[model samples]
Target: MGVEVLTVSSKGQIVLPVKMRRTIGITDGDKLAAFASDDGVIMLKVVKVPTVQDFKVRLDEAKDWAESVGYKEEDISDIIKSVRLAKRENSN
Candidate 1:
């Protein structure tokens, strides 16, 4: 891991050093998840938001798997409710 000192601008923006950005594969227009702690520690993580096409692809895969496993459409609601009830009981 490498450390680089950064100064936050008045508008709450900070420029990541070129070396750090290159190492982490960060480019212009990339999204980052920022986390701040009560102790003043801050962390940044690269995040990718899925497009609608991506979500549809995943949904299709899930539907295919459900069909192959013999899970009918009518069974999903009962399965979800039972799972939620079990979780609530366990948490208590």
Candidate 2:
């Protein structure tokens, strides 16, 4: 794609060209993460924020997999503590 100049409106918003938007697969209501660098570079990235339902679905899937693998809920704390201890020892 060639370079396309964009003009910012008085409201400090720039309209992404339809062609560019289509190429990048950006749609309405999508969230964008914007970053500005010291070198005057600006970037926008599409980011997904999981909804409560999405998180619940993922949690349910994880629970189902853990149950299928015979992992009980009581093992989580020990597993996390062991991982943290291992990480602390490795960092030292």
Candidate 3:
């Protein structure tokens, strides 16, 4: 577990300390999400989904719409699988 105490500054910036950031490999420009549990346990989660960049998301939706309109585009699942594998390697 992390340290049990933290300070929220007057300017509303909550600085995460060095050791916690080191454990997560977080750096500038990464996005984060904050949520609270039913029992009032507020949490900050590193967003892994956003780490998977939005490669061809709009194209995927367009493909689905095209198929619905009886205009089929060729399946590119294999290409996506390869790209996802490469991205996983790169993120690591």
Candidate 4:
């Protein structure tokens, strides 16, 4: 683990140290997901936003796997309905 003390600017922006950025390959304009814990600790993670093509590729793979497992279209639809009903019941 590496630790570096950083000072927040007037606009509440803190420059990530060059060493840390180089280590993590964080370039300028990269999207970062920030989270704050109950203990006042902040964590930043590099966000890899998935494109529509990515979703389509994953869905195709899932469909192929399901077909190989002998699941038909109606079977998939029934599974989805069952899951949605279970979710509604749990939420209530």
Assess every candidate by TM-score.
Answer: 0.46, 0.46, 0.41, 0.45
Candidate 1 residue 86 C-alpha distance from true site, Å: 53
- Residues 1-92 of candidate 3: C-alpha lDDT, one tens digit per residue: 33334677999678878787777777888667553334232344456543223324534675688688765434445545676687777679
Where model 2 places Cα greater than 4 Å from the true spot, the runs are 49-92
| Residue-pair clashes, model 3 | 0
| Clashing residue pairs found in predicted model 1 | none
CA-RMSD of model 4: 14.9
Can you tell me which runs of candidate 3 are displaced by over 4 Å?
37-41, 49-92
Clash numbers, per candidate: 0, 0, 0, 0
- In model 4, the clashing pairs are none
Residue lDDT tens for model 2, 1-92: 54455788999998889998888888998776553334233344456755556545656787799999998988877866787787777679
- Candidate 4 residues 1-92, lDDT tens each? 34555688999888888889888888988876553334233445446765556555656786799999999876856876777787777679
- Alpha carbon lDDT of each predicted model: 0.69, 0.69, 0.57, 0.68
Q: C-alpha displacement of 39 in model 4, angstroms?
A: 1.7
Rank ordering of all candidates by lDDT, starting from the highest:
1, 2, 4, 3
